[model samples]
Target: MLDPKLMDEPARIAALDRYDVLDTPREPGFDRITNLVRSILGVPISAISLLDRDRQWFKSLNGLDASETPRDIAFCDYTIRQRAPMIVTDAHADARFCDNPYVIGDPNIRSYAGIPLETPDGYNIGSLCAIDIVPRQFDPGQIAILQNLAALVVEQLELRRIAERDHLTGALTRRAFLGEMNRAIALFERHQRPASLLLFDIDHFKQINDNHGHPAGDQVIRGIARLCTGLQRPSDSLGRLGGEEFGILLPETGQEDAARAAQRFCETIAATEIPGTPPLRVTVSFGVAELRSDWPTCESWLAVADMALYEAKRSGRNRVAIARHDASHAT
Candidate 1:
């Protein structure tokens, strides 16, 4: 029986969402493990199941089985709800199994054992289970090996999660951001659809550390990051390029749009009230530039924006400056 209280639907759904790995095609590494289990144990079926909202989705499976089954009839559902292995020696003999559709009808699972697949933090996401038409028993060694295999499944899932994330701001961290930027630039160059980059930096961030304290400065940096993130559009990318500097990649935006975004970033920082500190207002300067066809690469296009940023700092701090590549660099 499933524990109603412990099997939190919302938390489980949230965990599944974080993986960003639903409905993906099967990978060979996962398939190999399921095949090995079936071959070694001489079972009719073996699977690496992921418990989804209303179904048990098989990432990997061996033998005749469907890719998905209803959650109500899913053995993996009960498997994940428990911390330890769920073993049913004879489905017909057990009270819980006798009433199960899987036991009485199709598949007729007579012998079953499943080990929970858990994340590093101990959230049991699903299970690695083996099924046989005939009743059977597993030795201690087999159970241990199955548990170890489930751990490997989790390791693979974690690797995929880290690959898609940006290490700095906990946002989409792919070099692919530039790939999208390039496409946007191409459209702007062709149809004059308008695009811009708001390159900016923390004003006197170094002095903040020297005066207030490094910890306070770190808080300020984090505060700025939050502000920038809050000001972003779904289509916009806000990333920390390096220390004390950040880049906002905007699409379909002109000088006015870029200037507005820059102003919002600066104002957000100024209005924020830092804890345990006097009313200290922070400011940021901006360099806005439009995309150009002559700039064949992302680097060259960004160079124009960077130059505008340099001018903003040189003219005076806490100001926005626009750079047109057609014009000479801001002196």
Candidate 2:
């Protein structure tokens, strides 16, 4: 039996949650590494394994035939539990693995070498492992090289996490938002199809700071953030540029669809009534901008949307404003 201290199932689950990499498709970089392992080690099976609650999932595999297998039958499970490299020269002879299904059954592992995949926090999530049907040995130098390769996998995962999140709203940040927006725009640009941007401002935000205090203001901000999260499409991104201002990147949507979405969001806020001691009410104004070929840069496209937003605030508070291009001018 595995020691409780060596493999805390609950702790491992929590570490996997932080990376948010479960069930994700095989990434090219990880696939390349596994391919290299198979070539160098001359193994019929090489895998980048991620330890799940009850299973070890192969994110990338060179010669493995299954997507996943029970963790109890996984050599990587034991490898993840170890601080140093785990080497089993002959699984049928080792007490820990002799009865294991992999050793006795299909794949019939005769030799295995596993290097634990670790997070920056030192939690071992799984292993980069190679398996062979015939017994073989790895030199000490070879073990060190495999460990370094696993470190590179961790580095890539960290970089991806940093790219997609907004620091303030905990939503998709601006860079990721715009990148998706550009992809959508390119698909619709040929037809001159358009989308809309909803620019929302927390009405009299400074007054909230002045009257109730900044702490209260912060609460309101968080309240608004909660309302907006998951409010838009999985493709659409909601973000906070700065201060009380926020924007949504809508894709493949016209002005009418944007207006309807904005209206529904406004009504949702009214019914919820953001948190406050005196039961304070909050409202947001929206600005809709249609995509145009004349606006070559994302900055210029956003400028038109911001202009429309300024108009919404100018006309009155808490209303949606539609963008109208000047026919006389190019855009």
Local distance difference test scores for all models: 0.76, 0.77
Off by over 4 Å in 2: 1-7, 173-226, 229-331
Candidate 2 lDDT by residue in tens digits, 124-165: 888998888987888887788788888887887788668667
- Candidate 1 matches the true fold with a TM-score of 0.53
Tell me, by TM-score, which candidate is best: 2
Question: Model 1: C-alpha RMSD to truth?
Answer: 9.3
- Give each model a TM-score: 0.53, 0.57
Pull out the clashing pairs in model 2.
none
Clash-forming residue pairs, model 1: none
Please report how far candidate 2 places residue 317 from its true position, in Å.
Answer: 15
